[model samples]
Target: MKTTRTAEGRVRAVIYVRISQDRSGAHLGVDRQREDCEALAERNGWEVVETYVDNDMSAYSGKPRKDYRRMLADLEDGTATVVIAWHTDRLHRSPTELEEYIDISERRGVTTHTCQAGPIDLATPSGRMVARMLGAVARHECEHKAERVARARLQKAKAGEWGGGIRPFGWGVPTGETATKFDKATGEEVEVPVLDLDKAVPEEAEALRVGADIILTDQSIHRWVRWLADKGFTSTQGNPIGHQAARDLLMRPRNAGIAVYRGEEIGKGSWEVVLDEPTFRAVVAILSDPSRRTTPGPEPKWFGSMIYRCGLDGCTETMICSRSGGANHPSYRCQTRHGGGRRGDKLDEYIEDLIIERLSRPDAHDLLLPGPGDVNVAALQAESEQIRRRLTDLAGLFGSGQITMAQFTEGSDMARAQLEGVNKQLGRAAVKDPLVPLVGAPDVRVAWKAMPLDQRRAVLRALMTVTVRPARRGRMPDGGYFDYETIEIGWKRSAQR
Candidate 1:
């Protein structure tokens, strides 16, 4: 190869190298390209001023290549009169990028050379045409490779195999005997992972199960966050599990042995189930409720803050917890300020005692619905599974070129809409009656105490409506105002004995 010299007497060159994937984190591919490029530069007597290498960076992914950008900057600054690479495809897999490179090279009077495809004079039309052609071929190969990879992944997902990523919590991949397969490329047998089945990580699985129960009972996700932190458990990234993380952890479909692809539930996975489907659905619904508060706010310290009603004349608004004028204790006052406040702690105690006494009755079991009422949980689950399978099949048809994109899109939209409706029904059905644990417990008081504030509040709201009537008389002997008579607990029709 003959190298052209600059007016200053020496030909300045820059070598650009890039490799798409480097699973070993070793730059062997780029290193080989760099070695070849250096040898070509040496043979041509071109002065190698810089070497730009973008390791594990794909030209087709449209991600920014830092070293490539730097090399371009150097070329623009007149630091190099020549650009060398292993091949024209190594320089660009995109036609638009090739055009830009051609424009820059033309303006800078810089020529490009490849160890394989030889020299490309950006200053001439023929050379630019050849570069564009090579770029187009590279783009075709990239798209083909992407299609093959997508199809392979979809097939794997359909087969209920692990799609491969960071291992999910509550599951462990065991070290088992490796299976060997004949490799056509190397003409030798290679050891492959037997079958990526994940077994239950006992402790993590138990934690997830407990989390599901807590979330299903309307407990705040913060409690689970605290539980995780106390248990010394962190996320796969080793970060302390926060409220959102806990919520997401409990909401994973994988916990229920359900596989998901691209945010859509596909079918059963190949992992051990950590949580039941109904419980998982219920927890997901609770955590994803739009009306649920996600902002930072104090948890309810009293059970009746929002459940108790302001029973003043013409003002039956819900009461809220409030502290008045440096009072040592907070009170439940009308949200609209229509009536006087009732001591929150006293009201909570009064309500809790009433609940314990009522649920302690022999007929407390009547409060629960007889076998899920009209929900048909099993049918809903089956229907949701069918819809998910339909969507997966539609995707397969589209990927395999059996259906046009338009047809696939329309079918998928309809199936997804159906799935959404069914999932919402599943979510609604997932709200197990909060009264189940308390109503039939051996000791209702102990069970009530063991229950979290949210669960207690849910039971209160469901069983009865407590109305805080106007205080009969102001201050009592202890300098506090709370009369049992002023607290009216009206049991709902569902709670009627």
Candidate 2:
């Protein structure tokens, strides 16, 4: 066994430093931490191998940084025997990350030292106990800070006070010590005196004009943001507002002269209201309306749109759903007259209805509602496992000089393609399950009536594999003979009743 003195002299160390945000004096913390870590390393006769510094990065979540994860990998691979930091909390606030480091220390024979907390020999039981206790304290501190900040926001919101952040579009921040308001409609300055808590309307209006209000309501802010964007207004950051950001702003109540923070109301005594009650209510109404809100360009027509195509040869024309002359009766018409070689024969509404009825029969249930059973699931899982194993084997072969680079690359590509195909099939199977029972149900007509256009299309695609040529007559059935002999109808399970 090696003596303690020899082991101590041979210890290799790495230093890690991190600061959450770039404050005016952020460099001071980084420099101080480095200095402390180096001093501890030198005092223990440990040879410092490398230094990893993460500036302006949070240790709370153990996310948003590549260097931090890389450090863990290095430790796991035995690249570093010891880690030195200013404090354990500086290394990690997340319990999971802390646990990972503890595991690495135990399995890889690594030790951690903090300038403030001294040596933590993770190989020993006492050291692990200390590390766990410290990790818990750090996690508590992070959570406590989050709770405190949340509480502060709630208090500020309840008072209808501006929480001292970026001003929204359609409003200007008050400059200096004096309060002033700008007219959004006229782009002119207006002298509006600040008011006490008694006068809510004027105060709120002033807040709105100055962009000092926090929206606090169920009303969506997307409509308002889009409206502002359409009017050539931008956010306080000089960036166009996104849908989600706009929604977040509108949902906050503080902008509407009411304050709510952390699920509680804490009205601000000094903050003035930005918008009048009537105007706020109107904005809310406009945002909540399904028709007025612009997303995906309207809900689209429920049926009778140009979404269907005739698949018959020589008659491969698109179908248009239209209402009969002077009537609300819907019908499907081929685009090309006499295109299908069957002259004067057109597909009528009745035939389409009959096809839908037939497809919805109980006998077609298996074709419509095929889901992944145990066999299919097991096959997919086994294929996935095989792909993973092949990749691993190829990597090993390459590493051991048993396979050429070209061969490895080719094998890897094939494995990846197979894996992708299996994944896609698995996804399709998931969607296929619902379609089977739906298409076979006897009451498919009712189902068709209730389903939206997109869902109807999905069912149509799953059931109909071939389009049947229709006997078409070009001119109206009651009129002179016209072009086109046949029309085509695709037979598939009907999702609609």
Candidate 3:
């Protein structure tokens, strides 16, 4: 192949620049690297033919580096006689990548020049050894740096300090200033921000509290997203909130003043709490419950649909809402096509009245059963952690061929079943009781009416089991309607009728 050159026979050069992170998207780091590489090229009398950049990309991460690949293609086609970089480490942190680069350099008879490491001549054995050694040292430094950063983050979590990231939703924004403070444990000066933790942003904090209530009350996350949009609340990226974002906001452990590392709760956070611990845990349980409806299907339009039972002899199947006779004739029918169907409007009205009357009594609070407040949360969390560790170790053993397939399957199934139970317990504990608001209300009917249909259904399922029995055999008058006597309501709790 022919090597490209300029007037005066100067070697054609291509500069490659990269930075691991460009949080501001400003390319400032890559700009500095390019300037240094250009100076090196000028000093060597090499004509700069092209420049390639991979901004906010890490060579060690195994992610594709588009511009880097393009530059390699340019080199293979003999577009440039030499490649310039700020440093060898900037060019590669993986030994495999370095080896590939060396192979291309050898085939193309191209050489590498760095501003920091000087020239690396791939044509000579001694030069190749030096390049390999440099690559090894760079790889070691990257791995060691990763270990240090992980440890630092864990330490910060244990100390209840805010580790650096995007500003949390409710937290105050950083002013981009740093101050030095002497660390008591390390006995060294550490740079911290002058203004870091203050009271949470009032409006955002309020929004979080409202969100927690929405989840606790069994309202849809779709509702929460609409609420967030209505309040003009955007994410840290200033984008409108979506369903997942809305759920994430409610699920954040920090809202309950809890410190977490790698998704595990470490301790309390050194910040203001927007939600009480019990309430926060309950909301999490409700959202994470495996049985919770996530995929879209037919949503219940009536309170008794899919919940009330058919009290017909030998047919006690659950009932479902049907509009077979048209919208005006919507009714609840037994799932097994049992003898008769009940009008949806009449059944819903009777159930609503029964619930309000039961909750309106002076002793209504007694009907509320034991809630998540009685759960041993710490013990459950510990057991969950242990099961996870066991699962990880089991996988490792299986991967190494230390255990038979049968043994692995048995162990995994047993451990998973136990984990499932533990998760369900935790979820139950975290879910808030729907009856909390309606019970002991000054205006019970008014408060019940204010609740959404789903929450009202929750209260119904919690308080009583309704069964629609077959209509009594008798000749009815022309204008006669639904008989409340045919509906049997059994109280779930032991309370005075």
Candidate 4:
């Protein structure tokens, strides 16, 4: 944030240049400020023996400015008789900093100059008063500007527009570059991200396409990431995409054309949609609640990604597989006495045999297809309810005279507009479960058998839900043995479609 130079002279001076913001990343404001400061020193016949700068650093933050301190030290050491800056505000925005600087300048008898605010004599009361007033005004301006920027960004978010961070995956600028404008206030060039519509990131969009395919599962999503990396795909920062990152890219609502703010889906994004809502929701369900909710690890290959909960009659606990009967006999057992060890092969083969039989049916394919209608009516209904609540709140504000009629009308219109859009979308939504295609296929048995563990779990979700229970213990003629009953199956009625 600083630059320095050394020169020799008896009447030596140090120039302190500071800029609060450098949006262009070019440091142009600092450059111009330095130029003006140098010209001021030459006109006054002051020899600039050194230069100190604090670029893109705010004095109002109360953090020590390194060059500002170094310049002060140079003054105390008798290295420079006068200090110059683009303005006193550039030197400080804090009234406290001005007061402290006044003591130092007065004791050390140092003269300070600005290209715009003219010279300041800290030794006198009037000069000190002027500095204090300027400091207060500058601080006020800084705070007001910050508030305005924050409000602007919030409005953008509310409108479902892009606000911060790099362009999201599966989105890019159609124009291939952002527009630029000269900011008169800072005299610097700034790129405007809002000017151009970001379409899709091409290679990344293809990855989203692969994600939308019913064939791709969370297990396959990682392979896709590696495959894309091989195709030269990288993040906006040019870093290799990791496993979880790829899952988020495919499953996050933002990638599916929805705009989320603070963990809530606010509305549709202005960017082009990559995956349809049904496909996106399907991916989310598979990635969020399936057997392999996290990255694939050392789960036994025999488990087949099915999440089994302990379903012993009268026992309400989830089942976890563990080694039983010494080191080798594995079982899916319930903690309750009503539950007994269900042999791994017995249970696994039973479920697979069930799926193979169910998929082989003539009308079962229809069940695999997503049911027609709004995908998530609960979320949409909640949103609509919130809008009504907002309108009620706005009316209350108006009645209490807290807001003008114009303000109330504006707020009401915004809420109603959002409600209308949400209602329209809600009326139009039809859910297509992700696993519908696989099970609905003529060769569903082959497809089910060929599916990866994660994909197979998705199928389990689309067609039927399974629960296991321990059967009554059976006693042999010579001894006793443990046994489990057939699992309870709850098939969704939609599969009949």
Model 2 scores worst on lDDT over the 10 consecutive residues at 211-220
Error of 1 at 281 (Å): 2.5
The order by descending TM-score is 1, 3, 4, 2
Arranged by lDDT with the best first, the candidates are 3, 1, 4, 2
Q: In angstroms, give how far residue 374 of model 2 lies from its true place.
A: 64
TM-score attained by model 1: 0.83
lDDT of 4 by residue, 31-109 (tens): 9999998998888777888899888898988998999899887777777668898888898888888878888888877
Candidate 1 structure quality by residue, lDDT tens digits, 1-497: 23345566779899999998875565679999999999999899888888999999999988889999998888888888899999988878887788889999998888999999999999899988888888888999999999899878867776767888776788765577687766655766689665345788788889998787777775568777777888999886688888877877887888888887677777888778887777777787778888777784776667777668887885788788989979998988898886667777777887788888888999888876444466788999899888887987898899899999999999999998998787777766666777888877888899989987777788887789888888878676666666777777788746763
Over 1-497, each residue of candidate 2 has an lDDT whose tens digit, in order, gives: 22212345567778999888754433667888999899998898887877888887898865766677777777776677889999998888877877878888898888888999988999889998998899899999889998898768756654555555555333343433445565555666667544333333433244243221222221224334544566665555677767666654543545545444444333333444454333343344434557644554443242323345555565556465545455444545566533332211233333436546765666655454443453365576567557756876887799899999999999989987886666555443333232543565667777765754455544544444323355454565657543223333455544342
Task: In angstroms, give how far residue 232 of model 2 lies from its true place.
Answer: 4.5
Q: Is candidate 1 or candidate 2 better by TM-score?
A: 1
In terms of lDDT, the poorest run of 10 residues in model 4 is 1-10
- For each candidate, give its TM-score against the true structure: 0.83, 0.47, 0.75, 0.63
Error of 1 at 60 (Å): 1.2
Query: Model 1: residues >4 Å from true position, as ranges?
Result: 1-8, 176-196, 305-324, 333-341, 373-382, 392-414, 421-430, 465-480, 483-490
Estimate the TM-score for candidate 3: 0.75
lDDT of each: 0.81, 0.59, 0.83, 0.70
> What digit string (tens of lDDT, one per residue) describes model 3 on residues 30-106?
99999999999999889999999999999999999999999999999999979999999999999999899999998
TM match of model 2 to true structure: 0.47
